[model samples]
Target: MIDGDDVGKRFAVVEHPMQPRALAAPMHRHHREDEYSFVLEGRIGAMLGDTVVIGNPGNLIFKPREQWHTFWNAGDTPARVLEIISPAGFEHYFRELGAELSNGPPDPQRLAALCARYALDMDMSSVPGLIQRFGVRFPGGPSPAPQ
Candidate 1:
C-alpha cells in the first residue's frame, strides 16, 4: 500500500508483480475509483471493457472506474505494474489480502465481503479462455468468486 492512503488522500500507488504467465487479479471493476497501470517490466495483456490491449515495459493503461477490466502477464518473463488508484483507500484491500493469505489459505467469503466494502466487483469466467489464448499458465490457481 502507498503512503497516500495512510494520509487520507485522493490517490495511492501499489506496485503489483505479475508473475510469468499468471493472472494479476480476477477480471473486475470498481465503482468508486479510477485506476491507471504503468508497465515496468515484461508484457501485460489486459481486457478493458470489450477490448483487449497488451502493453510492454514503459507502457501505460487506464481503467476508468466502473469499467470491467482484467490483466495478466503474457510473456515468458515476470512483469511489474505500478497501479495508481485515484480517490484513495481502496489500496487497503490489496494490503489486507496479503495479510489475510499469509495467515493461511485464501478465504473467498472474506474477500468477497472486503471487496463489497470497497465497491469492487469481480469476475473470473474468462480465465480459462485467456490462458489458452495467450498460451500461458494460470499458476495463480483458482480464481476469486464472482461478485
Candidate 2:
C-alpha cells in the first residue's frame, strides 16, 4: 500500500476487497486522475464508456481521466484489487466517501458536495442498468447470487 505523498504525489495505491458481485461505485469520471486496477483475486468487470471488459487475476485495467467508468466483482466469490490512482489526491475522496458511508446511507446533498469537491461526475441513474446487465449488486441494492 502506498500513499501519493510517499510517491511525491505521482500516484497512490489502495487495496479494495469486494464482496461477491459487488458494484464498487456508480458510473463516474474523474477530471484529474487516471486509475489502474490490478486484479489480485477473483474476477473484475469494468465498463469504460460503452465497452465492457473483464480482468482476471494478474490482469490490469486502465481507466483514463474523464472517461465514464465503473467496475464490479463479476464472480460469485470475494474479489480483491489494487487500485493505482495517478497524479494523487483522489484517494482522499475515497476516504471521505468511506466516512460518509459509515454514517449510514449518505445524505444526497452531502454526497453531491463531496463528489463536486473531488471533481468527480457521477451518473446515479446508470446504476440500475449496470446492476441488471452484469447481475452485480450495489451496496444497499438487491442481494447478489449465492456465493
Candidate 3:
C-alpha cells in the first residue's frame, strides 16, 4: 500500500499497484520547480503542452517550470514511477489533492471542474480509447460501461 497519503517533505518510499487512469495533477505551471520522473515498469504517457511522450523502463522525463504537463500510466500492467520536484516544497499540492480525491472518484463534472481549476483541459471523448488501451478503472466505479 502506498502511504503516499502520509505527509512531509521527505517521502517514505512505498509502492502500490494503481488501477490505470489518466491521473492529472491540478494544472499549475511551476515557475521555479522542475518535475522529474522515472518509469520503473509499463508505459507512462506524459502530456506537456501539445506534446505527448510515452515512457517505459529506463525512460526519464523532465518538465521545466512554465510548461504545463501531467502523466498517466498507459499499459496493461500497472506502471510504477518515482517523481521528484526540484527547488523543494512542491509536493504539498499533490498531498492535498490526493486527500480530497482519496474519498472516491469525482463525478465527471467534478473531475472537469478540478481540472479546470488546475488548468488541465482534458477531452474525455477519447477517454474510452484510453481506458481500452490502458486498462484503467476509477477508484470505486465499475469497469467503464460500454460507450
Candidate 4:
C-alpha cells in the first residue's frame, strides 16, 4: 500500500490479488474519492456506472466518486489489479479493517463504526446476486468492502 502521508495527499495505491472467480469488492461508492483499477494479469469484470465489461491485462477502469461500482476476476485463472484511489487517505480504512479482523470474524458494530469514520458507503444487498450472476466469490460475512 502507498501511504497517503508520503504522497502529498495526491493518491494512494494498493495491489490486490483477484483469485479465480473472486469479487474484489461489493457494490459501493466513495463520495469523496475516485478510484481506478489497472489490471495486472488475467481478466477482470467491472461495473462502472451502468456499463458492465470484462477487462484484460493492461486495461484501466475508472470509478469516479459518487458512482456505485464493483470488480471481480472474470477468468478461470487468478488475476491481479492495482487500485489507485485519488486524494489519498482511504488506505487507512483497509489498514484498520485488517487490524479489526485479526481478532476474529468482523463485528458489525465495529465495521459500521469504521465505515463511518472513513465516510464510506457500502452495500451488500446485491452481493448474492452478483456472486450468482457473475460466478464470483464473496468474502463470506457481513463485510461490505473489499480486503
Candidate 5:
C-alpha cells in the first residue's frame, strides 16, 4: 500500500493476493532489491536457491537480492502476503508486468526486455518442474518444455 517514493526509496510495501496453488512467478532473482514477504493468510512455500521453506500466517520470509528464488501459495485456500522491497523500484516491475498481462499473453521478448530493465533474471524453463514438484499452478495455460 506504500510506494517507494513515500518512504524515500528505502522500501515499498505491496500486498499480493494469491489463489490456492498459485505460483507467483518463474524462478527468478533480483539484482537490485531484496524482498521480505510477511504471510498474512494461508501458507506460502518458497525456494531460495536450492533451499525450500514454508511460512504460515505471522511468518516472514526473506529473499535477498541475487538469490534465485520463487514462492507460491502452498495451501488449498486463498493466501495473502505483504511484500516489502528494499531500496525500492522493483515494485514497479510488478505493475508493468500486470499491465502487459492485461493485454493477453505476454510476448517472450517483451517480457525478457522488461525483466532486463528491472535487473531481474528469470528461468522460464523452471516452471514445469516447479509445477510438478510442488503441485502449484503457473498463471498461463500449459507448461513450457524445459530448455
Candidate 6:
C-alpha cells in the first residue's frame, strides 16, 4: 500500500458503488498526517472516537493524525467521494494493502498483524451484526486482533 515516509500532500478522487454491505477501513490512526473526505453522493457514516457522524453529499469529514476513525456508505445507494491527504506518502500503505487484499480472500491473521503495525484495531462484537446485514465475512477468523 503506502510507505510511511513518502506520503505527501495530494488530492484523490474516487467513485465507489453504493453496495448494501457496510464496508470498512480497518481501524487506524495516522501518526503523522491529517485526512479529509468530501462526499459527492449519498450518505456516509463515519466513526470518530465514540461518535458516529452521518455525512451526506456536500459534507466534509476530517480526521487528524493519531485519531482513530473509520467510514462506510450508510445509505442504500452508491457514493462518490474526494479524499484529501496532507503529506502524500501514506498512499503507499493503502495501495499496497489494497493490492494484497485484492487477491481472492484476505488472511485475517496477516491483516491483524498489519493493522497492529499501523496502529489499527477493529472491534469484533459488531461483526455478527455486520455479517447479518451485509452477508460478508473475513477469511481468517472471527476476530482478527491479537488477544
TM-score for each model: 0.86, 0.96, 0.59, 0.89, 0.95, 0.67
lDDT of 1 by residue, 63-107 (tens): 999899888887778899999989887888887878877877578
Per-model lDDT? 0.81, 0.93, 0.58, 0.84, 0.93, 0.61
> For every candidate structure, what is the RMSD over all alpha carbons to the true structure, in angstroms?
4.5, 1.6, 5.8, 4.1, 3.2, 6.3
| Alpha-carbon runs more than 4 Å astray in model 4 | 141-147
Model 6 lDDT, full chain set? 0.61
Off by over 4 Å in 5: 142-147
List the candidates ranked by TM-score, beginning with the highest: 2, 5, 4, 1, 6, 3
For model 6, the stretches where C-alpha displacement exceeds 4 angstroms are 1-18, 108-147
lDDT of 3 by residue, 1-147 (tens): 223345443333323234455343333455656777777877887777668798889898777777866667666567787776654545544554576678776567766565555443445454454445444544443364343
Worst 10 residues of 6 by lDDT: 138-147
lDDT of 2 by residue, 1-147 (tens): 888989899999999999989999999999999999999999999999999999999999999999999999999899999999999999899889999999788899999999999999999998888888888899988865443
Better of 1 and 6 by lDDT: 1
Candidate 2 ranges with C-alpha deviation above 4 Å: 144-147
Higher-scoring candidate on TM-score, 1 or 5: 5
Given candidate 6, what's the lDDT at residue 20? 33
Which of the predicted structures, 1 or 2, would earn the higher TM-score when compared with the native? 2
